[model samples]
Target: MLDPKLMDEPARIAALDRYDVLDTPREPGFDRITNLVRSILGVPISAISLLDRDRQWFKSLNGLDASETPRDIAFCDYTIRQRAPMIVTDAHADARFCDNPYVIGDPNIRSYAGIPLETPDGYNIGSLCAIDIVPRQFDPGQIAILQNLAALVVEQLELRRIAERDHLTGALTRRAFLGEMNRAIALFERHQRPASLLLFDIDHFKQINDNHGHPAGDQVIRGIARLCTGLQRPSDSLGRLGGEEFGILLPETGQEDAARAAQRFCETIAATEIPGTPPLRVTVSFGVAELRSDWPTCESWLAVADMALYEAKRSGRNRVAIARHDASHAT
Candidate 1:
């Protein structure tokens, strides 16, 4: 039996949650590494394994035939539990693995070498492992090289996490938002199809700071953030540029669809009534901008949307404003 201290199932689950990499498709970089392992080690099976609650999932595999297998039958499970490299020269002879299904059954592992995949926090999530049907040995130098390769996998995962999140709203940040927006725009640009941007401002935000205090203001901000999260499409991104201002990147949507979405969001806020001691009410104004070929840069496209937003605030508070291009001018 595995020691409780060596493999805390609950702790491992929590570490996997932080990376948010479960069930994700095989990434090219990880696939390349596994391919290299198979070539160098001359193994019929090489895998980048991620330890799940009850299973070890192969994110990338060179010669493995299954997507996943029970963790109890996984050599990587034991490898993840170890601080140093785990080497089993002959699984049928080792007490820990002799009865294991992999050793006795299909794949019939005769030799295995596993290097634990670790997070920056030192939690071992799984292993980069190679398996062979015939017994073989790895030199000490070879073990060190495999460990370094696993470190590179961790580095890539960290970089991806940093790219997609907004620091303030905990939503998709601006860079990721715009990148998706550009992809959508390119698909619709040929037809001159358009989308809309909803620019929302927390009405009299400074007054909230002045009257109730900044702490209260912060609460309101968080309240608004909660309302907006998951409010838009999985493709659409909601973000906070700065201060009380926020924007949504809508894709493949016209002005009418944007207006309807904005209206529904406004009504949702009214019914919820953001948190406050005196039961304070909050409202947001929206600005809709249609995509145009004349606006070559994302900055210029956003400028038109911001202009429309300024108009919404100018006309009155808490209303949606539609963008109208000047026919006389190019855009």
Candidate 2:
């Protein structure tokens, strides 16, 4: 079995998530580095691999047709464990890899080298790797070049993260979230495909901090972030929108479906315990709004949702409210 300890570390996994690079579209910066690794090492295949819980996903691939593979048979998994350059001189002669399915069949990797990609906070997220079908020795000088390329990958990841992520909850920031919402809105305009917005506010959140402490309050915030993230679809996005509030952008989702999702969140939030608190459970009020052909602008989309959220807050506390055409005009 693969090293269970390295694969299960939450801090390292979370560090990988903070980069927000997994399953994201290819970019030239990462592509260029993979290209450089291929050239520098004279390998047939190269990739920028990001490790997730069950799979090693490639953010950039050159000379490889596949996008991902299971973690158990992944050479990159071993590379991530040591956070160093891991070179398998000859997979056919090595006990650890000789019978591996990948080597025995397609891609037929015989020699492999992976340089670990590190976050600034010191977690090794994944690797920049070079693979060849023929066994060979790795020159020390070539390995140094591969390490430098790995550094460039890290630099790009950190830059993308700072610009796109919220520092507190590990969700997208308000600006970034709305930026995506705007694109969904444009898609709605051109294609008439429906998208829904869910805005939720923690019920009685001030008491979390007042009764416990600021540290406890922060734990609650992070917990809510995790809960909402677990409830979202692959294409859906969850984001922290200022204090005590979060936004979910659900493209190709309708109002009723969004409400069902919000209800799930309400139930989950109430049942969840804050990591640092003995009895602190959170309840949230939701404002769900779907795009309307009659709506004038993107600003109106949020306005409608915010008004629904206000109604949810006013009606009781921990319930969901939907925005309708008539409701949009209501004070």
Candidate 3:
């Protein structure tokens, strides 16, 4: 039976989601820690595991063949539910894991030690675990080392979260946005998946800053970001591409769908009254560009979208423009 705490909780799930590390490619920063842990602990397998809604995903698996396992059967699940490290000397003697598939079948986990990867706000998002195929007791000094290593994992997560987001609007920073775009481009190149980019900026943003104080301008920026986030799908990524300009990367979407989304954002901004002392109103222009197979780089893809944005501003602000195959624009 699963622990009661393992049941889905909105706040816990949200806390895990904030790190945005699930399903991401392995990085050396995490891989190094897992490798070091496995070597130092003399364990065959070491993994940086994140407990998601239904599965335990491994950010870095040193010796495991599988990347994830069901949450109900995950040892890391039990580890994350407590503050202290969980050390099991023998899985066969433990009723909780005696019948577990991993214990009964391949990899036959006999000994396990895990430390909860607790966030700064006191949430245990996941665990750093070391697994041995043979039964062995983990000494107090070994547990302490594992606990210290887990802290480093948490620090890495915090650093990544800080580096990826814009300070004011809470959107992806320009560098991070482009990095995601590059990843999307690689995915498209590998699997021929559809993706699109929507670049937009506030109309007469300078005038707003000129009329109202800088604080009001900041509020407007935050408001626009919130609106865009609310309108976007979970797969879509919104990024603050400097100043009043923002970009949204829509995976598994085409040019038409991206243009429609941009149109919705454009209309919404024009209609909604931003909260302020005077309750300011604003409008925005948008440019949509679909990822093409022939594009050489992410910058080329961005250049097309930027051209479309220039066309929108040139024709008239507060409208959506799409980039075509021939470098022509359609509004």
Index of the highest-lDDT prediction: 3
Report the Cα lDDT for candidate 1. 0.77
RMSD of candidates 1 onward, in order:
9.2, 9.0, 4.6
Q: What TM-scores do the predictions have?
A: 0.57, 0.59, 0.75
Worst 10 residues of 3 by lDDT: 1-10
Q: Judging by lDDT, tell me the better candidate of 1 and 2.
A: 2
Instruction: Write candidate 3's Cα lDDT for 217-312 as tens digits.
Output: 899999999999999999999999999999999999998888889999999999999998668999999989899965547778888888889889
Which sections of candidate 3 miss by over 4 Å?
A: 1-8, 175-196, 202-223, 226-236, 250-254, 268-283, 290-304, 310-317, 325-331
User: Distance from true position, residue 6, model 3, in Å?
Assistant: 6.7
Please give, for residues 215-318, the per-residue lDDT of candidate 1 as tens digits.
78777777777887747786566877677877887777877898888877777765676767755678877777767665545676777777777788899868
lDDT by candidate, in order shown: 0.77, 0.85, 0.89
Better of 2 and 3 by TM-score: 3
Error of 3 at 20 (Å): 2.6
TM-score of 1: 0.57
